[model samples]
Target: MNSTKCQKCGLTNFATDLECKRCGTSFVQKTRNSGSRPKFSIIAVVMFAGVAAAFYYVFTGVQGSVDKVNSVEANRVNAQPVLPPDAGRSRADYDRYRSQTVANAVGVSPGLAEHANRTQQTDKAMDQMTNSRAQ
Candidate 1:
């Protein structure tokens, strides 16, 4: 290899030298593109490792949970709520009967009907304003 002078001490050494080889001064700071990564690069490596570990744990945990649910289903016919065998009919049935009783005879409040009419008029006015502006 060819020789070059050190910028700090002016000492001459081979071109492939890392240090001055005389004053012990470093030739230049190592960069990422230069062969191996430096020891101080732990931050980036640790962050990458942490993200990968977290993703791995999440994926494996989700897979385990899914497998557990599938196994439970495979071992049983179906799951049912913990209720008495002769449980009474649900409240929905009573509500259904009430709704049917009031279906045709249901009445709307006069105030609500007036509010709806006002809303329709306001919408029509706004539409007219927008059309006028566009022209």
Candidate 2:
């Protein structure tokens, strides 16, 4: 006949018995098999690492392309037109030409907004010159 050992009182009991007779402890046999636990595999780890690296590579490539396009647009918008050299011009004529150049450049290049302020100063100076000559 098969017998089960009581863990609490160390009493041997028949397998059919529900509880130990001496201490009233239940007799349940513990299995020593380790098959229920999960085992580690290197292939799973390597595959996960490869998928992470692929996502990083794709994200970086897209970000780099966007940055490159933004830089190109910035360079194009910031570019200023080159003007020809002025030769043999009176002070009033040169000031008038410069004012006209700045006025024409007002919405063409966003970077020239600061230089547009000089057109107002040029007009003020021209008015002063004309008023002084009239007086």
Candidate 3:
């Protein structure tokens, strides 16, 4: 069989021998393969890309919803109350003026008017519950 030469002892040794038989010198070579990292497979790369894309999609969708909520809140905060010059002269006059303002804001449609009324009632109920709990 072909043999390997031991560098330290200058002795010929069998290729499978870990050390020189004559001087007991180690003949083992450190493998280069142990230091190299394995390459990523195509399936692993595709899975990572898919997860990243899903995260991006979810993030943008949530951000868009947050932006819409912020815009609506800004509009509500910036809205000016509509009132007549003669408003608040008496309780009855004030009530009529308030009703007119609400009607204008909620639209003239019967369905819209009912919806607005229900929303107002819901707000009142929630406020009552909160006040009661506070007490």
lDDT scores in order: 0.76, 0.81, 0.83
- TM-score, per-candidate, Cα-based: 0.31, 0.34, 0.37
For candidate 3, write residues 50-90 as lDDT tens digits.
Answer: 99999999999999999999999999878967656774399
Pick the winner on lDDT between candidates 1 and 3.
3
lDDT tens readout by residue for model 2, 34-58: 3455667999999999999999999
Which 10-residue window of candidate 1 scores lowest in summed lDDT? 30-39
Best by TM-score: 3
Best by lDDT: 3
Residue clash pairs of candidate 3: none
Q: After superposition, how far is residue 25 of candidate 2 from its true place, in Å?
A: 16
